[model samples]
Target chain A: MADTDSSQRVQEILTQATEELKSIKVPNDDQLEYDLGNLLVSNNNTLDETLTRDPEKIDSYLHNLARDSIQALLNRVWELPSERIDSDIYATLPKPTTRLPREKPVPKPRPPTKWEKYAREKGINNRKKDKKVWDDVLKRWVPRFGYRKIAAEKEKNWVKEVPSNADPFEDQFAKAAEMKKENVAKNEFQRLRNIAKNKKIKVPSVGVTGNEYASKNELSMAMHHAKHATASRGKFQPELPNEKKVKGLGKKRKIEFTTGSGQVEKKRNIEVLEKMDKPSLNLDGAIHKEIRDENVAMDLKRKGGKVYGRRSKMGGRHRTKSDHKSLKLGTGFQGKGKGKGKGKGKPKGKPNVGAKKKIGGPKMQGKGRPAGKGKMKGKGKGK
Target chain B: MRPLKNEETVLVFTKLKKYIGSNVRALLERSDGLYCFRLHNGRIYYVKEDIMKFAATLPRDNIVSLGVCFGKITKGGKFLLHITALDFLHPYCQNKIWIKESAEQNFMYGNHVYKSGLSRISENTPKYAGVVVLSSKDIPLGFGVAAKATAECRHADPMDIICFHQADIGEYVRNEEALI
Candidate 1:
């Protein structure tokens, strides 16, 4: 009785949504930003709209609603950036008025195909490479990045000495990774449990252990078989019904395209219709190719070879006890053999099989007759 | 190529029943959807409609077959959303953004939300949620993909691109329905 159900799950989602809505409705500066939906929920506890009788509540609500129109004035900005915005925290919203260009991409110079004999005359030799400049201007000093330079500058004795302290904490990424592993395990367990419940089957213990690779092989084989079966079914599925459906849905469209000469105009889709019937429609005749493979598989099996085939355990969807019926239903495969001894028309005593059951109300017989006098019988019982 | 395994089908069914209402039979309602189910290489694939051929080239087993997405494949693949799922979940989803009547008219003609065309947005629309585009009367005008977080959108002007209109399943769809 205490187990969780669909309704309870829905309730949980509703509660979560309500909590989120509460965040939006947090009464900014004592002004209630209540919409008409909120009014109904607060007063009537339903989505049904009704007239508000309380003048004070109405006044406050109207005032807040008017303030929402201030969002209009908020949109009128003096200076805003044209570039795409990635984020906007409440404390520091990005605005072109105050924003400075953060990065300018440096153009990378490609090496020349051939150095000119008069390169010095062409002013190409005026530029000094970073290595040359470093050796000439700054001796015994390696180039440091922006942050490293700042750190080195701050390491002087003139600065105030701060007390050394340390608080150890795992990186957020590492913490999240650990938590995510647990979450993955929990979710997998839940999925397995659900599958077991649905199929009314018992689940094995949580670990597959050594059977993992074998299971993978089996799963892939099943997938291949299923894929082939789908291809065949789709290729052979009746297209006539869909053609009729198209014609039926376009009765008015046909009328709209009537020629002035009173002759019916063929739709432009005739070419498409022809193309669909062609081998090009079925993935360039992959369906027939798969069918050939299946036939080959059948022949190989008939030759008593223990080779990889469609009927093998790895291939095809794993059929359950119930699905086994679908594999054999009404095909007269085994059902034909059952009725061999008996006549074809009808069975001996089974009334429902043929025209043997007597229809309508039962006939009154001599021994089955009841006594007349319904009014007297009721009065007698009452007395 | 093969029918779905009992374990696989049952697992997917349970998920659909939870995320969608129990009334939707999903795989059970149609024998076609059930019989053609594929559990290939650990991934589940069922074609209700559209381009499901991508299942053949699926990279891994992490997918839950939402349905067949016909268009662009992302870094993850077409974000799985079955038509049945879309239809069943249309109302409850908080990611749908409704536009004004004027914008709705132009939206079907290939113009998305211009300035002064916004009407309403559904609840707690999170970052990168697939959004259903709705007209003023709340009829679906295909779908949109949110490009930014809420805080970004809140600070953005009406002219800014908050969502990228993806598929156009609107009045324009009527002409193609009969042809195919």
Candidate 2:
């Protein structure tokens, strides 16, 4: 029993020596500063010469110093707050005192749109409106815009009273609907214009003023052309401040030349070739001829001159018997009045028909008369 | 290398279609992989998609050429088919003309094939249609447009032109500087 008691005392003494060795003690203990929130501790206390100088004891001594620092930090963290997260106890960390450098600079504010600028100038504060509004007729809330909204109210009416100035047969309902459509289109156009203005894109002119030569558009266009006249195509030219990216204002057209998968290109090529292969006749000459004929007819009527006859303008000669008789009588009278007039004019009037029929072969057979064999023979005998 | 512009694509495709007819589509999209046409220094290269993507990363100056050089677009906007395109053209050519052994050297000299040199012509070959000119042993020497229809060739004089020479393999040496 005495031996066992003695062995227990020896074991207790060994454990006490090890415990003493594990506990680190440094001079000026209060000088050690720590930030528990950052889990950092700064130990400015002088190190013990015995532990640091001995290579074998250096690791354990340094480890004991770290453990003591960590324990103090944990104890300070535990005193602050505790929370249950996902059924696990967690000590809430305080806000870090250290100011870290930013990864990127603060972003610039977005430029105001045209409408926003206008609103600001007018001292208008934007207020959010409710999406749904109460409808009296339906007795239920409906959206302000889109999806069962009370839009185009005028068009929704089944019957509309026409004004006295309006035609009685006119569809007033359709007219109302068209007006509403025009209004919507105008609003949409204005919205798009505002967006384009904000984006620095030049809007197309609504109309050309009479004094366009002196207009801003003309000046800008001239300047644009002059700038592009350079060898570098205005690339090296000096730029004006606050310049809007208007198309044709020293900007080359961004041609999205269809890159070759070759499908679209092939289709386009085939279409072009097909169009080229197709026989497209130009009927402009024919149309001009008709216009000319109409103008000539109108001129003759205006002058109070009788129209010679119904002339076939499309090359087909559609002469009546009366026309031929008139021609023959007029030519015969003219020939008697002027000696060689009949010889020149008679053939012009009759040869096309008479020569084709082979009836008026010889001048002695007939002159300025219809080509008939029996009539010609009888006329010859009588002569 | 960059994807060909519409005009350049159309120009290349049209020239390719002249020889292969509608089979130009087969060249565009093949069973092996999707192939695309790219333009590099006026030369149109028919490259596979993956190789094209890889080549795109390379500096333009470093790359001499890629894939098959089908042809080049001249400054005058005319597409000139190179003899390098003969490999793709021979398989899909719609019509073919074969010449006799004695006149093979004459054709190589870039002269138009005469009726006396014509050994066998493809049946129903249309007049002015693109045809592959082959030797008597069935080797494609070059390509050209048929000067006369198959039916008109029977009565044509020996001195009469049978095939108008467009391009020949002999151009590889003679017109070496101009070729890609």
Candidate 3:
């Protein structure tokens, strides 16, 4: 009886020891959610306070935490259905739920050709024909078009019966061949015209406008184009004797100065100055500034706390929720405790006025920086 | 060298289509870069647009060749596919004829493949259809037109011609100057 009682006591001690080991780290039920397919684990619970704050033990604690998460993820993966593939067992992963952004921009749709547009409006449906067609004469299936086509049969005719009024010496086969060539050329010309039309390019002249019928300006343009049409681009063309130079040909007159003395030069200078006086604002610079500011604002929203992790313009003060509110109101520089430690560190080159200086000074400089750095040197005392 | 005129494109494509059939679309539309057909002298070259642009910078007479010379546009307006284009056509050829080992030398010597020489022919190959000639081991030897349909070939006499040889490997040695 004593032996059995001792055995029971030993069993109880062993069970108790195991229980103590299990209780050392309680598994937080809400700690992590696993997507085994993607090998992704999202942790919702905060880091264990004692482990994270303890400087010396932080590294090992974090390592063990990661190991446990991965262990849990692998366990879930093991539960998934597996199949043998090429002598190896593989766990087929599910499609990833995350949607990544496309590397390239979405392709623009092709513009409809004139025929396509017309067909759509008229509700015309195109019916495709078989490539091979029955040839009654040849008594075989022949391609409707292309090499060895049925259309080539006409070119095969050796003998022709001529009319009584027709000349007997005239070659009928040559006429048929010439007619076929003309047809091919006509089709090619039409195809080229359609391509030009679809691409919105100017239709080239088709012998419709000649020197006799064309306007003087049109004739001159044609003449100018013809002169440069030679192999050496008219550079080595032999000049005809007593040939006069065509006006407005070759390079345009480069800023011609009058033969007259001081008066002509003064008039040209005055004209140049007047042209420069016209208000020609660089709108591109303003547009670029606006785009940059929008990007910075987007980054700030995504990061939650900082814009580029730099101190705000209010002299080393971190931007707050109120600062964003004031920024939206165009009073970005006028937040609470506007100028604290720094001595009146107003942005240089831009003075804050009644209401006109509402547009941020940093933005007005094109980049998110104060302009005229000569006056604002040594402004940033290390953080 | 210049871009093929519209009629020339149609002519060249039609000739290429004879061998590749509808698979001609694969040659035209590729993801890598733009490819185009250029007419240099009398020859039609299937070239990449990048190389063609570079070639354009050279004087017209200086460039002897550019890209893969598919064939030449004869003065009579017929586009003849050369043996140089065998590599491109081998994979895409719709009809094929495999010749016997005993006849490989005869084919390479630019002789028409006879009935006894043809070991195998693709089923349903029509007469006069463009076909890639292959060795008994299935390696492309050359290309030609089927002289007899698949059905006709069954009852053809051993002495009869099976495939009319348009181009062969021997042309590389025999007609080397004319090839370019």
Q: Evaluated with DockQ, which candidate comes out highest?
A: 2
How far residue A11's Cα lies from its native spot in candidate 2, in Å, is 97
Sorted into a CAPRI-style docking class, model 2 comes out as incorrect
Order of the predicted models by TM-score, top scorer first: 2, 3, 1
Q: What is the per-residue lDDT of model 2 for residues A225-319, given as tens digits with 9 covering 90 to 100?
A: 66778999999989889764445436574543424444554455456445444567657987876766664454334222465555656864333
Full-model lDDT, candidate 1: 0.42
Please rank every candidate by DockQ, starting with the best: 2, 1, 3
Model 3 B-chain TM:
0.97
Interface RMSD of each: 19.6, 4.8, 24.6
Q: Put down candidate 1 lDDT per residue, A256-303, tens digits, no spaces.
A: 211121111112222323343356455747877776565445333322
lDDT of each: 0.42, 0.70, 0.70
State the lDDT of candidate 3 residue by residue for A1-383, as single tens digits. 99999999999999999976633332662468766656787667788888889998999988877767776776667778897521235576776665558757998786676677899999998889998888676677878788877365754354677879888998887877899999999778767767887677855342452335566555556655677799889887776676556565468635332122333433443343344445577789988766656545543442244556443577643454645665687764331221223445443322223222344323231223233321111222211
- For each candidate in turn, give its C-alpha RMSD to the true structure in angstroms: 36.2, 25.1, 43.8
Indicate the TM-score of model 2.
0.39
Worst 10 residues of 1 chain B by lDDT: B66-75
Candidate 3 residue runs with Cα over 4 Å from true position: A1-383
- Residue-level lDDT for A7 in candidate 3: 100
